[model samples]
Target: MKRSVLKFGGSSVADFPKIKDISLYLKERIEKGEQLIVVVSAMGKTTDNLLASVHDLTDNPNDKDLAMLLTTGEQQTISFLSLVLNDIGVRAKPLTGYQAGIETIGKHLKSKISSIKGDLLENLFEEHDLLIVAGFQGFNKEGELTTLGRGGSDTTAVAIASAMQCPCEIYTDVTGVYSTDPRIFPEAKRWDQISFEEMMEMSALGAGVLETRSVELANNHNIPIYLGKTLSDEKGTWIVPNDQILERKAVTGVALDKEMAHITITYPSHDRQFLSDLFKLLEDAEINVDMISQIQNQDGQQFSFTFKESDEKELIRLFNALKETYPDLYFKIETTYCKVSVIGAGMRDMTGVASKIFKTLLDADITFYQVTTSEISVSYVVDEANGEKATRLLCQTFNL
Candidate 1:
């Protein structure tokens, strides 16, 4: 029998009433003879609340214990969802990451799916109409629970879909993927179809519609992802191969990333080996460095880099460690910046995209601290307050 995976975000399964509504949606699909696997996130703000509670108790908690505490949120959703479905006369079974056989490998709080033992899931399909799996968590080889950090649930849904060789449907609060965030630009247009590469770029550039890791996983496994609202019948966006998109635009979307921190470090020497060693430390720490700039003078060299705000503490810890090695190293941190980017697969074959982006920002009199470009996208760092304005102007300039 063919199988399909449907993933509901936190907002969709927020309360009992919402869970009952999702059961109805699943019941309709079961009536149509669709074998289903439902992956769900924690209830609305449940994970955040859990983290807050933990922090209130202690400033520093053990990573393994923290992951153990966090996994309970998704586990709660799985149980509640399964109970709701059974109440509606639909046969549903609930499984945690371990029970479902999602094996992972990495650090405690942020692990990646190493592989899945899918025989258990295949067997469950015989007796149940729907299998409810908790998202965002799995057990590592040491038999310890681990979470996937941000977008962990989305990664779980896509990973299961890939293993099952089925299409994945992600149900969120939005109707579909928009050219830009609708809240930032009310006139932003929603896309009916988007190429995986385009979506990947947008996701990586800070589009919140889908997680970047999920898109990368889907693309790697050649799976198509359907994104839509949980309860609405409105049409959503299809993320597929680039070849499947007939008409490609020069600029498909604008994305804004507000959670960023900029750091600049000045060293006493201009030696190349010093810079390499500093970056090697960051690499070993798994810090994702972006938008890097280097300036050198007769006195010393200064390096600037941007990274996710959430990683600021880790970065600072590494900086302190490095300071012990280079006693004269001076560093400054700025948390008031955001990155706005324009993405389009068509940019690979188009010209003047960078110029257009710069001209647009210049015409708007927006001051940018740094600029970076990939083959298919151009990114600029501006003050957090101007993020929306930059995104809107880029969207209109490209007619996205």
Candidate 2:
């Protein structure tokens, strides 16, 4: 029998009616002789609401207990989805991540998949036409529950598809991947297919359609992913190998990340060891820093980097501690920054892409604080207020 994995986001299966609609959709597919595995996220705002509840109880919650609390959301989703499916006369079995043999290893709330016991799924296939597994939460070797951070459900779906060697279909509210956020620029165009590399860049740079780790897994395992609207049969975007993409645009998309903050640290010492130790401190704290720039001045050397706004409070606390320890280090934090990026696979073969981006932003009267580039992407840091305008102008200039 043909096998496929279908993943539904929270918005897709938000309520009982939506779940019933999904059940009927799956029933038609199952009747066509296809054995399926279904993955689902917590219903609309369930995870967020749970997190809010946790915060309401305490200013700081234990990671282990937090993970334990969060997994219940997905559990609720899987059980509810199974109930709706069974009510509609579709034989469905619901499994938690642990029950489905998903083994992960890492700290609570940000674990990585270590391995999956495919044999367990294979055995269940004989008895159940559809296996509904909760997404985002998994078990570690220590037998602790762990959540896969934000967009973890996408990672779960791709990991399962990779393990089972089946095509993965991700159903979300959006019809497909767009050149820019359609909400920001309603004229944004969707792609029929996107290269895995380009799509990964977009996801990492804030195109929230797919998770970055999920794209990496799919790319590594040669798993083709179909992304589209949950209930519509519209032609969506296919993320596949670069060879599968027939046409490559110079600029495939524009991605905007509004939750970014910029930090600059200046120290009186010019020693490289000081810089190295500072980075080690951030690493020990599990703070991810991006788009780093270094400058040497008459007073000392300065380092600037960008990180998620969610980490701002922790980062500030760390910097304060560092100041007390170093006694000679000065730091400044800018929380009103956003990252705007242009991504495309054809960037490697193109010329003057960075210049074009700079010219467009300049013409829009937008000033950038920092600029960074990779083989397939160019990113700029600008004031959060100017992010949308910069993105729209760049989209128009590049015709993305």
Candidate 3:
């Protein structure tokens, strides 16, 4: 018998009424002979509330304590969802990530899925009418609770589906993956299907279409993701294995991110040793540089490079810490910034992708400070205030 894994996001399982509606949706699927495993996120903004409590208590709360606090949100959802299913005369069992055998490594807030022993889950699905598993939280070999950090719920769902060898359907607030954010561009159309590569780049480039890690897992395990809206029967985007037919034009989507800072290090001269030393500084500070670009000075000696502003604070901290050693190597940090990216697989083989994207911005009279690209995506750094306007104009030009 074919099995299907269904995951509902915070909005999908938000309230009692929404739970009831989702329960009906599941019940009908079960009645039709589909073996079901439902993964659910924390009800509404429960996780956010818990994080708020953590923030109030400590500047950097212990990882173990935070994980314990975060797990409760999903636990509440699982228990309530199981109860709702039972109330509807369906036999359902709620399981935590531990009980379902989602094992991981790492302490506290940043754990990665190591392995999943699904025997218990298999038994429950065989014995019960439905199985409801809490998403996001997992356990390690030592039986310590762990989490996959931000956007963990989506990763949880994809991991479960991959481990169980079934397609996972994700229910969120949007009807499907849109060319652009519908909130910003009301006329944007939802895509019928998106290749995993495109989706991965889109998510990583700040599209928020799906969690990047989830897309990575799906692509790794060859699992399909059905994205749909929770509030309606609208068929959302289907993220599947890379398909030639599904590939779009030079640009498939546009994305903008507001959380960025820029840091540039200019030293006395452009030397390989200085470049290596600077990167080591970032590594020591644990700053992840995104969209980095380097240019040689006119003298062909000194060098300057730019990275996201999110790394600005740490870069400065590290520089100040080492100011005595490399006074000349110290540089300035800039924080006010945003990045807008045009992501697609077609861009790799196309000629005018970048030209068209930049032209759209020029036509809109939007001044961009920087431009960067990978084989699958191109991004521009622009003023934070014009982020949405840039995204809308690019979306219109690409007809995304």
Which 10-residue span in candidate 1 carries the lowest summed lDDT? 268-277
* Candidate 1 residue 207 C-alpha distance from true site, Å: 0.6
Scored by lDDT, the top model is 1
List TM-score per model, in order.
0.98, 0.97, 0.89
lDDT (CA) for every model shown?
0.92, 0.91, 0.82
Best by TM-score: 1
- Indicate whether candidate 2 or candidate 3 has the larger lDDT: 2
Rank list by TM-score: 1, 2, 3
> Model 2 scores what on Cα lDDT?
0.91
lDDT of 3 at 15: 91
In model 3, the worst 10-residue window by lDDT is: 299-308
Query: In angstroms, how far off is 74's CA in candidate 1?
Result: 0.3
Candidates ranked, most accurate by lDDT first = 1, 2, 3
